[model samples]
Target: MSKRSNWAVPYLIFLVIFVALPLILIVVYAFQGQDGGFTFKNVTNFFTDGDALNTFAVSIEVAIENTLICLLLGYPAAYILANKDLNKSAVTVILFILPMWINALMRTLATAELFNVLGFSLGKGTLLFGLVYDYLPFMIYPIYNVLLKMDTSYAEAAADLGATPVQVFGKVTLPLSMPGISSGILMVFMPTVSTFAISEFLTNNKIKLFGTIIQENINSSMWNYGAALSLIMLLIIGLTTLLLGGDKENAVEGGTV
Candidate 1:
């Protein structure tokens, strides 16, 4: 092998041991019974369990809500940051990314404390707020990078054709930015659906998201069941990623048109 290819040996080993092995174990355990025999009970339980199904539905609902809010908020912020006339300083971009320097747990704790200090009760609202705050940066940076990298000639050409600013954005900028928006949605939506700590901290353990259910089962020594739940979540996330990937490719092709 070439010297450059040799450098990948360590990373390949790490991937097999840490990533591949863990995923294989999850799948193996997911189909195993507590007696260590092969069975389909764990997977069947998830489908038959009303509470698990309800929690999964709730998690999806929350994820969709959070993704929409982040898009609405982040797209404007990204647009402003990318627009040279609106924002010129790199410092402004850094300011938006500064919060990410701190760990998410720390930020969530601070938010919880802030809400407490203001005498606000913790519930669904706080959960949503914490989720959006943590994931908004994920959404913004993707769109910002895309918008910033985009050629301004398209918009300029549209303007020269007597297209209004709004028309230019709608016809040119928006289509070109769809790939970034897809990436941001994928980044924000998947994690929001599967995050446990943020929901726990913000809601004071009142709300039970799908991740919390998986965690609870694992903690209770229901390894097989937990693995099944994890596998389900992994499958859903994988499917979403594939769907978004297709959309991103389509957007790229459309932008070139």
Candidate 2:
């Protein structure tokens, strides 16, 4: 073992204690009944319960919409920012990132106040807006990083070969940026699906997403149900990550070929 390898010891310990331990507890709780006996009812309820199914569907819809909107908006912004001729691009990037420095709760509360001032009614539309606004940076940063790090030679070569700007972007830039797009989708989608606070503030507790349902369950001392719900969410996010990971890997391989 090298000395540099020892540097990971603390991180490994932290992961096991905080991350692994909590996941283990969730699994344990998810299978435990109110009488402290093993049962699969909590897990089954996720599939069989109508309310649970509705919440799950709503969460999926919101997450998908949020991800799509972010991609549509973030991709173009990232492309613009990545332009070499854009003056003060660094400053523009900084401005985009500056909002992240404030506390999330503070920012969320401020957004809620802004909506109130504008007389926007609290509903699903506002909730969607809040989700997108809060997570937009997560989408932008990944794409921007990938664009920034990309070699210009590929694009220049394509241009020299008489490829139009659209063709160059479609064939070269977009394909090469798949890894970043995948990452951004994961970052935005996962958080939006699991978000409670944004829904709460934006909709005034009228909208109950998966995260809100989990929060309610836990608060009402339905730990087993809550754990099961959380595990379901974990599975969805895990599957999404796997799918996107495959796409990213394929993109990288394609780029190399």
Cα TM-score per model: 0.94, 0.92
Lowest summed lDDT over 10 consecutive residues: which window, candidate 1?
A: 248-257
For all predictions, the C-alpha RMSD in Å is: 3.2, 3.5
Best-fitting candidate, scored by lDDT? 1
Candidates' lDDT values, in order?
Answer: 0.91, 0.87
Candidate 2 local lDDT, 40-144, one digit each (tens) = 999998889898899889989999999999999999988888877773458898777677677777888888999999999999999988888888887888888
In model 1, residue pairs whose N, Cα or C atoms come closer than 3 Å (at least 3 residues apart or on different chains), thus clashing, are none
Off by over 4 Å in 2: 1-9, 247-257
